[model samples]
Target: MAHSSNDEFFAKLVELFDYRKGKDHGSIVLTQKRLTYDQPLPEATSDTILPDLHPPQPMPILIRATNAKGKEKRRAKEKVKLSTVVDADNLPAFFERYAEVCKVGMNTLKPRDRRRKGKAKKKKGGAAAVGGP
Candidate 1:
């Protein structure tokens, strides 16, 4: 397999991230599971601390399908994102570098005023023909 360029890699990374725009109003709450209750239950009297466990990270994998003759075709190629186990020790450093790059990109953007001043409307007939008493 050949290595991809940094720009291509970054583009793929962004694509994998797949950030979405949030709703204009109200908040969106995410839940792992849904539960049905007849009435309100008692609140927790104490807090519980859970042990930290490292889980496998999910990474994207490009999958390709071969033709009937066992020939791989470009059109039949598909990207299958499969979960892979990997260490996340460098995640913090990666995030820091990403933030710095993002800051630089943001700085390059110039804020321009979008609102334009209204232009004066011109009269239909100039001076209205002085000859017509």
Candidate 2:
């Protein structure tokens, strides 16, 4: 049995995606693949004030599950959409869940090229950058 309620399911979804910022219009906009910063976003448990993406995928997003539905099943058709918007408060949990669904284990994601955006700083500088120095 699915133990999660509708609200719980949706809440987790929001968390997995991080609220960041979305359009204020009544509908949420779906993005085409935005080349990820090519770096894994900072993890959620950071003691810092804000998190990059709750679930963190090292690669750019090719698709959002909410926007994953389509007539061809594998191809995204224009008329397909599973969700339009998510609540901001639920962002934390949803982003995690989505990462899991996508199999983004801590060390499993492939390293992506980040030089296009003017050279992404790698943390080989150590945890110091994340406040650990």
Candidate 3:
């Protein structure tokens, strides 16, 4: 039963493939389109309709900082996104490779310490520190 379901999903995924184009990275627009492809459109009940697509832009305050330090901070954090549309045809292969890598990564990953490292504890036996007047 699970095998048949997986097959069906694979078939659907293959149907969305574009053979002419290929990519090594993901795209937000493509992801959104793929996600909402089969979904039913909402009824236009209201007069005011909002647009769906909006590109990311840096905050005005961050870009136009009063001090040099603020501008330097923004420059340090800001990164250019070099995105390309991923080939839908290679999706299954890519996912399989990703899964294998993840399995290996999980094996190599070290367990993190959950305890918070706070201020050092004061000496309990020191008479000078706890002495009463």
Candidate 4:
């Protein structure tokens, strides 16, 4: 198949699987014939999708601070190494300070919790009971 055709097919497949449970769209292994458009159109399978070999783990953040002064006669100071896990609640604050200190944006920070919207539903009778006795 032509490159464009392959791209279009991939897009459709992604759209189809985007909301499907237990589906991974990353890292596909296309058959040689499919790539070359040879006879007997190649088939696609979930074989390309591998389970998460390494589960998510929190990594630490490191910060270093230094102060120095003047010519031949000089003074230098260092601060303790600090570490933190990046999370939704704290990420914006972390980045704000990080940018100020490092002068570089660290895009590697992953959200500890996925973005969630809206309030959770209350139990059926819990609200009514709370106002009584």
Who wins the lDDT comparison? Answer: 2
Which segments of candidate 1 are over 4 A away from where they belong?
Answer: 1-87, 108-133
TM-score of each: 0.22, 0.24, 0.22, 0.20
Candidate 2 per-residue lDDT, tens place, 1-133, comes to 2224435544544543343224222222334353344455665554754565444433333333343334675353433233323334545675666556444322333476455434334544433534642
Candidate 4: which stretches are off by over 4 Å? 1-55, 68-89, 100-133
Whole-model alpha-carbon lDDT for candidate 1: 0.32
> What's model 3's lDDT at 115?
32
Mind giving the per-residue lDDT tens digits that candidate 3 earns over 34-133?
Answer: 3222334444445535322321221111000011223566589532211122245555665585355334433324454233232113334344434744
> Which pairs of residues clash in candidate 1, taking residues 3 or more apart in a chain or in different chains?
none
lDDT values of the candidates? 0.32, 0.42, 0.32, 0.32
- Model 3 misplaced regions, further than 4 Å: 1-74, 77-82, 104-133
| Candidate closer to the true structure by TM-score (higher is better), 1 or 2 | 2
Which lDDT tens digits does candidate 1 get at residues 63-131? 211112222533455332212211245445544654554444333245652332321122223234323
In the range 75-126, model 4's lDDT, one tens digit per residue, is 3322111222333354467556544433222223454433222211444455
